[model samples]
Target: MPTDTVRYGMISTAKIGINAHIPAAVKSHNSEIVAICSRFDGPAKQAAEENGIGRWYGSYEELLADPDIDAVVNPLPNSMHHEWTIKAAEAGKHILCEKPIAVTMDEVREMTAAAEANGVLLVEAFTHRLNPHMRRARQLVGEGAVGDVRHFEAVLAFTSRDTSTDVRLKPELAGGGLWDAGCYSVSAARFILGGEPVRAAGFAADSGNYGVDTSFSGLLEFPGGAIAHMRSSVEQPGTNMGEVIGTKGKIRIPHLFEEDTPLVITNADGEERVETFAGEPRFVVQFNDFSECVLTGKAPEFPPEDGLANTAAVLALYASASSGQITAVERV
Candidate 1:
């Protein structure tokens, strides 16, 4: 492991890694993708050839054995995140795992513990939080531009062509709208509120094929009387939107998750303002941040504990949806 650059071994050739993380790593000055692995050799070889990577492994363990690699990017399936992250930590490699780091808090705790014990950094890869527009929104709200945040609403949805074949529709794999897309809304709401919800209540409708929730709508109650409404679905037209309403004003984000766009702010006196942010590739920002954290031995801006908080909230929402009652989010 060289201190000058973070050599990365990619855990899978998933679409997110191929389309986002790999490109971002290439563009980053402090990191490089040295190896890539897949369950089979052909896809790994293809990804390595196409991306100009030097090594390809048919199994993840082979990639982990490379002493020259300093970090690993775990873009594996949701169910695999906890397992691979712990393995990477044990291998003495810092990790950048995908969002909703785990389906449950127990897994989150175990992953965090493993990383801490191994003296490695483990960061949840939530690209939206790294977006300049998102930072600006948080800044404005923090500055009281929203006049003491009272409520938040977020919605994210996209239609899947084949629910039967998609991993997102598999219940055993921790797949569903809430785990897949809704986690964004829950995370965003938590970020804006800057606190965990005390109680959660929700409803979900399962897809007939796999018994995975195709649609989920939930409410979160924060300690300060602030409320958050979140909705997500895999059976609807694509939509991404969020709003933070306060005593004196409100801020609206048109594309909350997928893109950088204008943020609209409206005051009680009928004054409206539009704020535009300089566009930068979000994945680039994410990769750079992870590299900086790993190299400097600094905790990630959004640490593993934050992922635990978000997962706790999501779990509470699921509990509420299941029991038809408000569920309290357990503090970890």
Candidate 2:
């Protein structure tokens, strides 16, 4: 690899890869999508040609073995995240992995250790942190626009009648509305609260097949007595939004995570404010941040540690739901 070029590789033709990440990588400055791999050759080759990428492979291992690839994006299913991330680390390739870093805390710990040992930068792509609007909301919360934050409210849901056994609904595939959508709510709550959640109380509905939750609602108690109530579901219609209400004033991210418009704020004086990210690409922002971290050896704002914390909160919620009691998140 030369100092003049940013060589990129992708591990899947997943929907996110095709729709969001690949386009962002191509549009990024001085970077090229060198190679991509998929279990299926048809889609992989099509995606490579359609997206103007250099080459396509029918397997992930071959892509990892390519020395020309400076960085690899892991857009595989949640269950496969740890295995391939470790492989990428071993191959000395910088990695940008999708959210919910791993299915378990132990797995996250192992992946983090491997990245550190292999000396490759590993980042979890949580696009909300890169959103300028969310950045402003964090600043407002820090500035005490909302007096000492007491309770937070977050909800994300959409209707999905598709019963084709997609990854989101299969426990084996690490699919669930919680991992699919709730990860965003948990990440937002953790981001705004600026600390790990200590306890969680939750309830989950079963689809009666694989035991994966179709919907989950939970309460996260952070340090200093701040509490966040969150919910996510695939059985609903359209998108639901979230809010961080403090004592003095409050910031309302009408929609968290996804490229939301018109983030609003209301103060005790009855004045209203809005922060807008005008015509911005959400995944592009995330790709830029990941590229900077890889190129400059900088720490990403949301790292694997943040992913671990969110996973802990999620596991605790599931446990609470099973036991019919509030469960505490053990520090990872």
Candidate 3:
């Protein structure tokens, strides 16, 4: 291994690891997938052979014990995040875990505690926040480009393939439209408004069929009097976009969580302008940033602590959905 380059053990042959991170690792100079692991030997061996990884293990423990690996990328199902992430931390490996970090506030605390105890870097994979589009949007809101942001709308919807077996549709896995997609909207609202919501109201547009939400809508009220209406779906098709409306203007994000997107701002006088960024995959950028953080000990702009607020707000919304009333955000 080259000095300062982070060697990763890719956990599971999950489609996301193969389709997104593998390609991203190829493009990253300081990051490499040195190994891969699955619960069975055959799949691990096949994935390793096909991907050109030098090492493959049948168990996560074996993968973690490999001295050649410096970190792990855990893209397991939502419910598995807390378990495997803590395991990776205990093994003295830094981690870049999938979004919605954990399903509950207690799990978030436990994961954070384990990482801090082990002196490992643990980051939630909200890669879009690392993109320039979101960075600039947050800046614009702060600079009054969207004067006194009063209202916002965010939506992320897509049709899933093989819903019967897809991990996203399983309730026991902590899967649902809100956990899979709406977390982005809630996080975006927090990012753009630069404040946490005081209260949240959620309504399940679709539920009971799968014991999880297929489509859902949520309303959040921020401390600064900003209101956000967000919708997410796993069984329907819709645009991935966000709009922040202010007293004097509004800013729009077309691809809310994708790296290759632009920001469109409209002023009180009806003038509009679009802000564009060069094309790049947010995941690739995230892969490289993980290495940078490992080697240089620099904190990510959106660190794991930031994810706590995100998970808390989502939990509040989930509680609201269940109780049939607006609920106060836990911390507020």
Global lDDT of each candidate: 0.89, 0.83, 0.89
Per-residue alpha-carbon lDDT of candidate 1 for residues 125-163, written as tens digits (9 for 90 to 100): 888876777788888887888887889999999998886
Ranking by TM-score: 1, 3, 2
- Model 3 lDDT tens row, 1-332: 45778999998998989888888998898899999999999999999999889999999889989888899999999999999999999999999998889999889999999999999999998766777888898999999987887899989999888888988899899999999999988988898788989899999865548888989899999977899998999988776888899999988888876776888989999999988887567888898888898998898777778889999899989999999999999882
Task: Name the lDDT of candidate 3.
Answer: 0.89
lDDT of each residue in 188-210, candidate 2, tens digit only = 88877777899999999965565
Superposed model 3: Cα runs more than 4 Å off: none
Clashing pairs in 1: none
Specify the poorest-scoring 10-residue window by lDDT in model 1: 253-262
- How high is each candidate's TM-score? 0.97, 0.95, 0.96
Tell me the number of clashing residue pairs for each predicted model: 0, 3, 0
Q: Which pairs of residues collide in model 2? A: 146-249, 147-248, 159-236
| Preferred candidate (TM-score higher): 1 or 3 | 1
Query: Ten consecutive residues with minimal summed lDDT in candidate 2?
Result: 253-262
